[model samples]
Target chain A: MIWAVALSAGALVASGAYLALSRDALRAVVGVSLIGAGANLVVLSAGRLDAVMPAFVPEGASRLADGAANPLPQALVLTAIVIGFSLTCFALALVMTIRQRVGDTDSTGLRAAEPPAGADGLPAFPDDER
Target chain B: MNADLTSLVVVAPLLVPLAAAVASTVSAGRPRVQQAIGLGGAILLLGSALVLARAVAAAGQVRTALGGWDAPFAIEFVADGVGASLVVLAAVMGLTALLFQQDDTDPAPASPAFVPLVHAFLAGACGAFLTGDLFNLYVWFEVVLIASLGLLVLGKERRHLDGALTYFVLNVVGTLFVLVGVALVYAATGHLNYVAIAHATMADPYRVLPFVAVLSVGFLVKAGAFPLFAWLPATYHTLPAPALALFAALGTKVGVYALLRTGGAVFPTVAPLMSDLLGWVAVGTMVTGVLGAAYHWDIRRILAFHSISQVGYILLGIALGTPGGAQGALVFALHHSLVKGSLFLIAALVCREAGSYDLRHIGGLSSARPWLAALFLLQALSLVGIPPLSGFWAKFLVVRETLVLGHVVWAATALAVGALTLYSMLKIWLEAFWRAHPREDWQPPPGARPASAIAAAGLAAVTTAFGLWPEPVLRFTFMAATVLHTRP
Candidate 1:
């Protein structure tokens, strides 16, 4: 079980990195979300998965059972998931805004902030330069 | 202070800003009310931070477990001297940024969320400084990340959208790296609290080196170190003067503080193994950052690159991994925060008076606005590490430490960076203040308020005061460094 989880997490991360390096802005955002999910899985697998009992103490007992699952990783993963979801939403929204405003979705084409060099090899100023 | 009072004081720096965020959001439509609430909250946060710093100074450290839970189970908020001082720095920057923004004419149009997001950013920064758990630190970092992204997009300009896209993507990846690092650390040590991790790692440092490396790389990305700082200059130029000042002051310093805490304090045994590599990274950051600054003509981009270079000096101090090195890092962080914040604010004033952020187009400020010129000169000299200023003393300590450790090449690189830093400052002076304005008909803006100048002046005064009377800050950072070196 551990081997399966680890291998899947590794694959997710590898594919995410590949997509994130793409020139398409939207694909890069999706790739970031994929990497975030893969990281969440890594956090989840940090706690052993073979526990027989739930992470609970018996009635009136003082402590959790020996084979009980660890609850901390679950809580951490929950927080990570929430943060990742919000960030992905924000990134997607930002990409949409970029598309509407800049009229391009290529990550390499988003040089409105730092314009490319002019024909003379000097830094070019955009029309709306501050 | 009593336990309850101490706990309240320990957490107040975080809660004050958060409460202000909520209040500001509720009063969003009314810019006046939001400004009032924001400034009032910042003042209260400063007060609380002072109290916390005082209590921690007296007791060496003050801590509390949330909801009255014990240390190992509940999340912890621990404020030693280092954390307390940083909290104080955040409060000061928050107050200054709010003051600078209050009466500015260049407000973010139609953006009622700006003030709330600033408060949220402050809250996250304070939380990161105070949290004792690694996972909690990651959470605080996300809070900072989300808030910063919101701030970057508040203006909704095309450049803002472009910049925010890169900032959001890069910083999210950095935070995910931190998440994986946290997970690995917890798996190895079975604990997330700093004290517990320290104890666990002390037994077998070699086993945890890879995890520490991952965490350090994540933080280095956030700190805008070499080869990972493309997002910094790409995005920071998109911010308004006030927001830029706040980000310049607190954003990367938080990452540097994290590096110090983990490397210099939590995992001392592993630190030695990593010090050589970090030292070289520091050199690379310094050289590359200065070179980038030299190539830029935009005042904001130049200062942004300088921010990266100054961070290299602080990282050098951390990379040294000695008591003296930590002391130098803490001192440099504080000094750089004040000086760089003032420099960005002064740049805004220059834009207001001269009509452009491009240095090539704006000039004659010395003849037109003498007082502003004087302020810029003082702050610029401080940045260049001239005599009797805060930067000189900061560089003195770090370079002296490096030389003492027989790393002559590192020390020489630091000094050479200082010279190149001076060159960049001179470029700003020659282009913006001394040379003639490109357009003969250019005139200063009308109805400009004194508030921005006063804000810049206030920060310059603090920097000058610290330079003149370096004993108190020096002693405070010394004690803070001691606290960091010894395990709880």
Candidate 2:
């Protein structure tokens, strides 16, 4: 169980780092989604993995029974998934708009939109510009 | 009645803004109706916050387990003095920003998205303040990020687009870190509620290091602390005037509040070292931000860089971890919100009268618009810690507290930062207002209304009002500090 948890966390972290460093905006979004998924799995897997059945135990079942899967993580995972999904959707929409207007999806291209450092003087007159 | 009122105070601040947001979304086709509903909701939240602060002050502390779920199992709405005070701050800033929004005469039709987005951000701020569950806090953070992103890009300007994209990416990274922290905390202890996690950590302090590190990174990014605040200046400068003021007023403060809550309550033992780290970061943030401001000639960008610098001082106050430090931090936080909000609004007023926020293009507006200049001077001096203004008192408190701790270096650094702040303020004044007027063709954008100028003046008045009679804010700040400093 520990091995499984560690593997998921490792994959999540790797994907997250890759996505963070990626130039493609869409891939970065995907990376974040993967990271969220991995974090959820790590949380859910932390509980006892040997539950003989679902958490609904019969009468007299010890609350701390060794094999019972903790329900808390399950609840938490559901919340995380919903929030993660919404964020991805919003991020994707933003990426779409950027592609439509800015004519590029690369993060490098996006940097071109930034104003020149300290280019803050008077607006030039139309006649002066020529 | 006061104790029972705690839940009402906590829930109403969140619900009112949400309900207003929903109503505004439905009525977005009608700009007037949308403004009415949104402004009404904000005003109510502010009123509710004041009442809540009063009740919390009389009662000391109050907790209501949400949905009757009991401490560990159910979510909680805990209102001690600190939480209540922040609610009031958020509400006031929300209403003030709404006033600016209402008066904006840009023929650019109101976004189909603005009112609802503001509503969501308001709810998220209140939710972040009131929630007792660590994961619940994460939920609110995402809510705020979504709402803010939507609002940030509503106008679809070239600059807004650029700022929003950068802001979005950085915040998403911050949220991911928070998720990692929450997951680890849940794993280390089977509890997600803050109180329960506090208990769990008390029993097994050695096991929670990874979780703590993850959580701190997330909150620090949101708060725009040193090293992680790369997105703030670019993004904040691009937001439209009212939205910019709101961001300046609330965004980083939320992160600071979260840090304070977590550092003081759930992880008290590690706070001294964490605060020391925060103190160093504050110094770095201040110096870097001020240097950036010096390099910029655009009025808006200069102010934007200074926001990053001023945030450092608040962090310094919190880093001390002493009661005096917390008190000073609270005072500084509230003072910054008003003065910063006012200052940003003043910039908007300048943009209204002067055609541009670029310092070189703007000039001689003081003679043309003395009232606007008066408002600008008031907020600027307040921000620079001029005597009898709110900013001065806040700086005095932070400096005194640092000296009390015998941290002469931090005290001196903070004082030096204050002087640098003055330099930047003077830079704006000289270039934007005192320079010779531009060509006759160069004028403020048409439809820049007197209403917005009045709104700017109104905000300036509020800043002065607080400065003149800070006893009320000071009392609340003291109560909040006492609550945090005293362990139950």
Which has the greatest lDDT?
Answer: 1
Interface RMSD values for all candidates? 5.0, 5.8
The CA lDDT at A31 in model 1 is 92
Task: State the fraction of real interface contacts model 1 keeps.
Answer: 0.51
Model 2 preserves the real interface contacts to a fraction of 0.33
Model 2 vs. true fold: TM? 0.94
Question: In terms of TM-score, which candidate is strongest?
Answer: 1
Please, what are the lDDT tens digits per residue for candidate 2 over residues B289-360?
888888787777788789888888888888888777888888888888888887887887676577667787
Clashing pairs in 2: A51-A67
* Tens-digit lDDT track of model 1 for B1-488: 67888789999999999999999999998988988999999999999999998888788889999886897878999998889999999999899888887665344443688789999999999999999999999999999999999899876777778888889878888888889999999999999999888989997999999998988888999999887888898888788778899999998987898999998777888889999999999999999999999998888889999999999999999999999999899889999999999999898888777866778778989988889899999999999999799999999999999988899999999999999999999999999999888889877777866778788999999999999999988888898899889866
Model 2, position B347, has a per-residue lDDT of: 80
